[model samples]
Target: MTLTIEGFDHRRVPVADGVSLNAAVGGSGSPVVLLHGFPQTHLMWRHVAADLAADHTVIAPDLRGYGASDKPADPDGRAYSKRTMAADVVALARALGHERFALAGHDRGALVALRAGLDHPDTVTHLASLDVLPTLDMWDVMRGASAAVGFHLYLMAQPPGLPEQMISASADAFFGSFLDGWANDPAAIPSDVRAEYLKASREAVPSIVADYRASASVDVEHDTADREAGNRLQMPVTVLQQDWGAALGYDAAALWEAWAADLEHTTVTSGHFMAEESPAAVVKALRALMAR
Candidate 1:
């Protein structure tokens, strides 16, 4: 009855001292890890993962604090930071017998993949980020009236109590709004999968808020430090994004080029949930990135 990536074997792989990630892995040959974004699970990768599995081993995991993954408490706000999350990805891959692999992510997962590429260059052979900018660039660009579009970011960035309380008060409405509003094709996420996303988000309010909260705080500090030290992704990177630049008054590709020397940035026509909305295009772009 549960929706899942068909043909993939699911496991709870230990990645930290006491935390583990719920991963769905399939296929063989070179490995490719896919990370899901907010309000969704590895199920988001069902279409793309199935296609990729024909040749490349595809491992799609629900990131920490989301879906069926362990939600460790964030007593000091460091628990859900992208750095910590990125580390989990590395450890997960290694535990699954992969010392090096291609990495790709969508939304929040893209942010994690970016950090992993920056922090562990030799381990990630190639990188792809879907529909997200880096943490520092993200905060830098959201200004004036256009910033209002990301009201949820500001809301979840608030200190622990209020954000969790308000979101929990009406979890379905809060999480469902994005699912309903952000997709170009609503049928891309059918009723069962949408129900699953809403259910997972409804139960993980505090941890989800902590994940977003870190982006506004500790994640920014880490990104700022990296920028100051001139740290960059030392691998081929591909970024697929919607044309948020024209509307927000900034160049997305130029911004990504600063962090990656070998970068291919493409503006996608699909909605924010591009992997589901345009799986063939996503698969093609990822295959090209891996080839490079």
Candidate 2:
């Protein structure tokens, strides 16, 4: 079955050089772009998007290299870097006549949103990240046994050939594990969305791994330079994450403080897919952040 969110108009919007993002746009008022995470599409915001659309223009897009978005091949893997992906979102919004927009992301999308804030502070009016730590803190807290549940991160961080090959061989099981495991209620995803996710992952193996590969290399370097230079998110930054720090023995909020000057850090009981598991909380947080 063809999966879609009601009240959203899907578009292949041009953004950055050599790329266009597949976005679902709806509603009016100030623009708000919602980005999807790994193993899922913008449909994850089905409930929240419509609600926000009543008050804001909601632009939900499959990040480059995922869903129906155009994936450009670039050497050195810089193309898939979060910095590049973030730029895609900013440009896409600008093309839609929004010079600045309220931006929110879940999981991998959060990483892209993080970069958008740093790289284009003037473009992103407010920033909300769901269920993820900033890249630097994420690597730091993955010490000792904290890395156990994040085996996929380690696997995809390796040199491309093997991870891509192995995952492609069993795409359904690989992606299904996260879709099932990370949700507070697995039924929140439903079966058709699950099938769409598996299909997208199967078709985009190399590009998907490239996104992760860039995270381990170029993405990290970009983040480190920003940190070393004492650069922080200039806007009101709200980070909504699962309490992985509690289980991993770290202060997730404190770690975020280092990167965000004006910060609202929160830990929710929902699993990794907080937007799906707890739409009301996600919507409330976003409305507050966008209020800034």
**For this target, which candidate reaches the highest TM-score against the unseen true structure?**
1
**Per-residue lDDT of 163-207 in model 1, one digit per residue for the tens?**
999999999999999999999999999999999999999989999
Q: Give Cα distance to truth, residue 231, candidate 1, Å.
A: 0.8
Residue-by-residue lDDT tens digits, candidate 2, 1-292: 7588897899998887778889999999999999999888888899899899998999999999998998777578799999999889988998889999989998899999999999998998899988888888888888777688889889999986899899989988999998988888887787888899898888888888899888889999999999999999999989887777667888988998999999998878888887877899999999999887
Q: Give every collision pair in model 1.
A: none
| Alpha-carbon TM-score of each model against the true structure | 0.99, 0.97
Q: Judged by lDDT, which candidate is best? A: 1
Q: List the residue pairs that clash in candidate 2.
A: none
Model 2 lDDT on a 0 to 1 scale: 0.89
- Against the unseen true structure, what C-alpha lDDT does each candidate score? 0.95, 0.89
Instruction: Give the Å error, residue 267, model 2.
Output: 1.3
